[model samples]
Target: MDIVEFLSERISEDEAVARTLLGDRTVSKSGAWYEQRLLLECEAKRRLIRIVESARQAALAAMVSTPDQDVGWIPQSLQWMEQSLNALALPYYDHPDFDQDWFRT
Candidate 1:
């Protein structure tokens, strides 16, 4: 899956976890709780971003080191990382007016 799909899935999973921890009624009942959850989700996204970037850099270095062989996957992987990073940079759940459909464009 592309970065957007990956991050979206991650966010959904995090939300599910939060729901389970706070219960459905309490999950959205308090601003402080919601903010805390959102911060946690953002931290997860940041970690994913770092991991993807590191992998992309490694692929790039490998591609450069072995120029003779077919390294087409390196470019594709870089593109995926770039897209995912872009998606992760968005306001996402950090904003009160966040919209899931905004990423569709």
Candidate 2:
């Protein structure tokens, strides 16, 4: 599956696991939401870091005596990646919990 779909499926699976293990408690959603939020932030941070590194390299290349024509895309790429980072950093709120017995029931 594509990355987005895969991520969604994995999140769903984790929710299922949590619910199965703990039976829909009041805190289940909180735990799952926190976990997913953290994962998304981490992924976004990693992607932004990569984009920054690439931009730095491209900027350095452009500073040299003979700059590559492709250096023009560096700023635009950074902007786009920054927007993505911001989007991912937004807080997601949802909290639900399940009891272990809920699974057996």
Candidate 3:
């Protein structure tokens, strides 16, 4: 798949994982919960980075093989990948509250 499609799929998968981690709670309240959540997020980020890196390398390789005019898509794709990496750095959930259950049912 293309970089945009691949990143979109990864984003959806990450959101699903977040939902599973949160369960019935809108926000995690336990430190342990946050820790576990961070681990999952980190793993997701790693996967995203890997995909982006691969796409970037492939784009660079393609730029060498194809005609200059036809290779314009490479820069745009790289920009999109950069933006995605930036978005991934932002926090998705609120701080722990210490009032909810440590483990959701």
Candidate 4:
């Protein structure tokens, strides 16, 4: 499943529900507040979904420019690497950069 596509579908659904809930009604003050909140939440999801590709690219860049090694930072970089693989449906340790033994240092 493409995560971004899945999220986009969800956002569409949320927007539809919001419209239906607020469509024909004369909302009270609190109802108006909730309606605004719901629309904002949907907008937030859309903004986040728009950045999914940027995240994937950043993760791939991390794999390409890894440090020689980082005791503290390697774990976080690994998480980013893992996220890239997850999005692409690749194996966890499929990249040459993951092989410490292959490095001359």
Candidate 5:
């Protein structure tokens, strides 16, 4: 189903099991919850990336093959392209240890 529901269901299940055994430390499942959240987030993001990529490809095809290139839809199409690029670029935008030279040819 939805990402939030999937994440919450998994996390709640984990927490319930943890509570039955761990007896509540100071962290009290915070670490486990965070880890689970991160895992779920990654999974959700993967699905989202696939969906966005499909839409981006469709938009690109439309932008390339359309006859009326001088219409207002061009700007909207450009905006979609930029947004899709930015969304896909987010994962690589920051890396504390990755030097710029590593990315250069």
Candidate 6:
């Protein structure tokens, strides 16, 4: 699968794992409930972090870079933006089938 599809699947799988972990969980005022809820919450949050990171990277990979004419040796804002984007660990950038590299190429 392509990076987008691969990441999308990962996100779906992660969401499923999160849902499973959080299934039927309820909270009360008891200390035991609080402690157990904390553990489950941590696990769910970790999975959520991964999903969010993947989505953010995909968005970054899809960003179009438009460099303006440079004056002297100083870089322009768009150039900086392009450089920052290129420096990111975007998995979508590695796939040959991904067509978002038209501007980067």
Best candidate per lDDT, number?
A: 1
- Preferred candidate (lDDT higher): 2 or 4: 4
User: How do all the candidates rank in terms of lDDT, highest first?
Assistant: 1, 3, 4, 5, 2, 6
Provide the lowest-lDDT 10-residue window in model 6: 66-75
Q: Can you write out model 4's per-residue Cα lDDT over 3-94, one digit (the tens) per residue?
A: 44544655676688877778757777787678779899888767655565666566666666875544455457656544543443222134
Q: For residues 10-42, what per-residue lDDT tens digits would candidate 6 score against the true structure?
A: 445545654555554563346445555655654
Model 4 scores a TM of 0.53
lDDT of 3: 0.60
Clashing pairs in 1: none
What TM-scores do the predictions have? 0.56, 0.38, 0.52, 0.53, 0.47, 0.32
- Cα shift from native, residue 83, model 6 (Å): 24
For candidate 5, the lDDT comes to 0.52
How accurate locally, in lDDT, is each candidate? 0.67, 0.49, 0.60, 0.57, 0.52, 0.46
Q: Model 2 residue 81 lDDT?
A: 48
The regions of model 4 sitting more than 4 angstroms off are 61-105
Error of 4 at 23 (Å): 1.8
Model 6 lDDT, residue 25, Cα: 53
What's the residue-level lDDT of 69 in candidate 4?
A: 47
Residue 88, candidate 3: how far off, in angstroms? 3.1
The Cα error of candidate 1 at residue 5, in Å, is 22
Residues 25-92 of candidate 2: C-alpha lDDT, one tens digit per residue:
65576776776665665555556556655765676666574564555665676566444533432322
Q: Looking at model 2, which ten-residue stretch has the lowest summed lDDT?
A: 93-102
